[model samples]
Target: MARVLHNCPAPAKLNLFLHVTGRRADGYHLLQTAFQLIDRSDSLDFDTRDDGVILRTTAVAGVEHDSDLIVRAARLLQQATGSNNGANIAVRKNLPMGGGLGGGSSDAATTLLALNYLWQTGLSRSQLMALGLQLGADVPFFLFGHNAFAEGVGEQLMRIDTPDHWFVVIEPGVSIPTAAIFASSELTRNSKPVKMLDFSGAYIRNGRNDLQAVATKLFPAVAEAIDWLGQHGTARMTGSGACVFCAFETRDEAEAVLASVPKKWRAWIARALDEHPLSHLQ
Candidate 1:
């Protein structure tokens, strides 16, 4: 029988705040943000196979199998270890794509972590993280295992304690491409950077997403969602987003607001998580 790792979770993350501090010469914008884990997630099941063939048994709409991050991460791990083993990865996706929830990156990180253990490749957490970075910037954070303050195109992570507040998230029913927002001429790229000490408090409204303006301007639905949610609290966009969220002090407060959210949009409430669900894997 093949060895299997089932129900491996890849939780969604909310960027408590995202600021474009500057632009690197390579065109990757410098960012400072706090990543907060939430209950919303994508889960995976890995079935080990003897042949050296990495495959995604589940298909995501509009995403090619060869282009899926899950497959790429698995293949990368194989190449790095020079291992002949392979696996069939089945994803149970619950998070929205292009909502800035880090779904794909999280899935990729989970693949790297899970396969390393299942295949008995014996890679360290730091080694896995280094390989994850080649997949995407947010991949390393998911592997980092805690809420963090990130910098340098979002690869620099310092564990930060986040408030246990509940968040109400609204998906505006549109896909906002991350590249479009970053490449926009109107996007702000020069917000003055702040020290980590300034954000150690992990308050709900510590800062703002510089990408929000460009995203909202390009997509009116996002602006409408933010405007509606802002009526309840300090509503803001997470990462380069199509989803907007507001943090509340308690579950009751978050649920109450969630009740009043317009029916035209998809919305839900999730409590903040201090660490990743897969933290124990390492």
Candidate 2:
């Protein structure tokens, strides 16, 4: 019997707080953020084929196969592993692209992990993370498979257990260009680095995103989203985003806020996951 293909989830991420502490000589910004996983996720199914590596994408809206990160990830894995057998990859994309949710990175990480298992490559998690770093900085965190504090262009990660909460994420009908935000001179390039312990109580009281002000200026929708969500509770933008999210004490509270969100904007309520969905693979 043909090996039954396995299906896996690629969860979204929220940057609870992001601070651009400095810039590297090479122009990469040094950042500090707490990455929290969310329940909302995209799905990927993998099956081995007899022919040369063929990547077939399903009906994913707003993404072309050639430009899709999943395809790029699969190709990267193929090249890195030097595998003779090609696999068919089907992605069911639910996460919005360029929303600063780390959807693409999660998908890439899933592809790397799934393929490694299916191919019997026996590559260790560290090995997979090394390969994932080539795809994207967030990719490594997903390979590590847990909530983490990230720094250094978001590649360096230290795992930590974060509080469990429900988040109401609101995405205004606008796409924030990450490159545009990063290139802006107005973006914050210096913030005092704080220790993890310093953040425990400080986060709830004074958590902040250095990019929020600049991003809001560039995209009014982000500002609007933040303003809208703040009506319910403390709200903040995650990463370089057009999406703003607010945490609630319970799922019902989050859902209650979701009901009142403007019809023009898209929104969802997701439980904050302490462990990444891919943790079992680790």
lDDT leader: 1
lDDT of each: 0.90, 0.83
Which parts of model 2 have CA positions greater than 4 angstroms off?
A: 1-6, 197-201
Encode model 2's per-residue lDDT on 11-68: one tens digit a residue.
9999988888999998888988888898999989888765656576486777788777
All candidates: CA RMSD in angstroms? 1.1, 1.7
- Tell me the RMSD of model 1 versus the true structure: 1.1
Task: List, residue by residue over 46-150, the lDDT tens digit for candidate 1.
Answer: 999999899899889989999999999999999999999999999998999999999999999999889998899999988998999999999999999999999
Model 1 lDDT at residue 124: 91
Question: Candidate 1 overall Cα lDDT vs. reference?
Answer: 0.90
**Best by the TM-score measure:** 1
